[model samples]
Target chain A: MEIKLSAPITKEKLAALKAGDRVLLTGTVYTARDQAHKRICEALTRGEDAPFELEGAIIYYVGPSPAPPGRPIGSAGPTTSYRMDPYAPALLDLGQAAMIGKGPRNEEVKKAIVRNGAVYFAAIGGAAALISKSVKSAEVIAYDDLGAEAVRRLEVEDMPLIVAIDSRGCDLYERD
Target chain B: MRELDVKEITEAIAGLSKETNVSLSEDVKSRICMMRMKETDEGAKSILETIEKNIKIAGEEDIPLCQDTGLACVFLDIGQDVHLVGGSLKDAVNEGVRRGYTEGYLRKSVVTDPIRRGNTGDNTPARIIYDIVPGDKVTITFAPKGFGSENMSRIAMLPPAAGEEGVKDFIVDAVRQAGGNPCPPVVVGVGIGSTFDGAALMAKKALLLPLDEHHEDPYYAAMEDELLERINKLGVGPQGFGGDTTAIGLRINTAPTHIAGMPVAVNINCHVARHKSVTL
Candidate 1:
């Protein structure tokens, strides 16, 4: 079913999703890609607080375009989720319940999801224009020097996504 | 020799970049439709349906069909007799990538340094592969490649004694191992008999083939069909949900190899498989 933008999505709601179960995510979802991920991981490694609290929050694995003046974001969409696998465990441990991106995660990530009861979801791999329609607001939160890879806060509505892996460690890609 | 202007080159590149991602090739559309007809899973059938719908939406709206708009990859066949009048051809191509990716509102996913942080802003420094050829015409094929399937790509060098079967077996292993991470039903491109790098190079290029077609060589053609059948039989199907068509198609381009070795590479692209060709 379609979830609207800026709507509060709970862990229970996310757990109910299955592979290809189209969702429209709204509200505040944070964006982080490669560089930002490295910094997050490093913080975790050093036992320092992450850039954001990350508790029960959804982290979108993305590096979006520079928004045009009047728009909140420029064509925001998920990147491949697998790349963020290296740092996912720590971020999840910090109470992050939902992660959004594309593709499958590795064994460690699957295990992390199961252990922490977190969720993995997929935004359409190339559906930028469709995705852009969901973002009602967006602003870079940190690491402006990181360019597109910087962390940003996006407020969206009805952004479509699917559950790729659930908290039970059931990987939709590997399992039914 | 005729001189080509930078603006013309840049515009051509930009136009082609935007076209490839939004316009799913007719061949790819028909092939997936055929595959969906044969698929049995209720979920997979619907997923394929959404995929088709996505193609339509992306085309009609002129937006990238997938979120990973991919790195700007250009394969150039430049005529030796032509002279680039105003600017470096590479610069013109990159400028095209920057304009296309930015103005088209596509994501710029390529990082300046793999180990370092951040993207290059515009998807600049395109991964360009150029081959100088005879005549005055230039053909450019732009395929914006995503890291998901691209990461699963593999190349290996086997003993010449291993022969075609060895290459076939290796490719099957790779695709099977890739599972759904590359996002199936993938387009498997096999480059054989070239050097390790060359084999990998053309393998990526092979994704440019029609979704249902095979290499023209009778032997390579047969190998392509055989591999396609074997991959489908794996039941990986669309999006790895399980069904008849694991891989939508296979294209193998072969060249003479070293006397003692056979270098083979398998480059698999997900069905989103965005690409287009332009002649200027």
Candidate 2:
């Protein structure tokens, strides 16, 4: 079913999402890929604060190209999600509500999603050019030296996605 | 012998590097369209449509097709009867990459060091493979390989006794393990019968082949058809939403092998499948 979801979603709303539901997400989301994920987890392990508020946050796994003239971003799309598996459960434990990426998450991530009422959304992989049109604005938030891997705050409009895994621990990847 | 200037090579590569990222060739577009027609699943069909839209948008707006513009891989086939002058071929290629990436607004995805992990900032130092041919012409094939699929690629050295079944199994398994990670409806290149590294190179090179073409030998041609069918049946679908189009194309390139070893490499490429060539 087609659903429109705004970011900073509540646990109640997250729980209502099911695997294979089409989502058009709008509002502010954070971009973090492999390097950024490692750093975020490391900071949490060091008992330091996350770069942004974790509660009700939607983190997108992406490393986009540099923005060209007259564009807010370039080729923004989801990267593979498995690389973030190690760090995802902790963020979910801390109240991060959803993750945007392509590919299946590990068992631990799935369990954590159910435990914390989170969802994993799959953006079309390699569909960057089309995806970029949804980004209304983007600003680098932290880890500047990481270049494309830097964390960014992006305002997206009607960003299309599919619920690859849901709060109830069902997965679209594992077809029966 | 024909005298060729490396400066000319640089200019050609620079254009090719940007051109490849901005637009996909007709062969790839047609294959995707064909798959879209064949796809039955609602979610998968929509994803295919989105891909088609993405391609059109990229071409129209001069935007890159994907965010991971990738590590520049340059294949130079220089004819034996040509003498290169004016500069180092390596430097020329790197310069071309630098200019192309910077000018085209393509992502600089390369790192200066694997361990230290510093962005090169210009996407230079292309992974260049050189070959010498009989004619007095130089052909450059440029493919920017994204790590998303590159990471899923594998090289396995099997016992010669593993035979055809084992090789087929390995290729299929690689795609299975890759699953949605490499971006399904992937293009798979299988390299068999060569030495370890050669097999890997061949597998990567095989991706440059036109998707609609088969190997000249009927034996391997049939194998290509079989492997393509098997991979698509994985149901990984477009973006792993579950459908019959797990892979769009599969190519196999082989070489003479050692007596006791059968090295196989599977190089998986995302649906973008960006590759272009220039003859200088």
lDDT for each residue of candidate 1 in B25-97, tens digit (9 for 90 to 100): 8888898899889888876776677677777766775666776778888988888987878878889999999
Query: For candidate 1, lDDT tens digit of each residue in A1-176?
Result: 45433335566766676655666676778889877898888877788877776887889988776565566766555666777888888888878888988777899988888888888887655456567777888778888888778888887777777777877877777753
Residue A75, model 2, lDDT: 91
Model 1 docking tier (incorrect/acceptable/medium/high): acceptable
TM-score of each: 0.89, 0.98
Candidate 2 per-residue lDDT over residues A88-157, each given as its tens digit: 9999999899999998888999999999889999999989999999999999999999889999999999
lDDT of 2 by residue, B89-125 (tens): 9999999999999988888898889987888889987
Model 1, residue A117: what's the lDDT?
A: 80
DockQ of each: 0.41, 0.87
Compared with the true structure, model 1 gives a TM-score of: 0.89
Measured by lDDT, the strongest candidate is: 2
Alpha-carbon local distance difference test for all models: 0.79, 0.92
Query: Cα deviation in Å at residue B246, candidate 1?
Result: 2.8
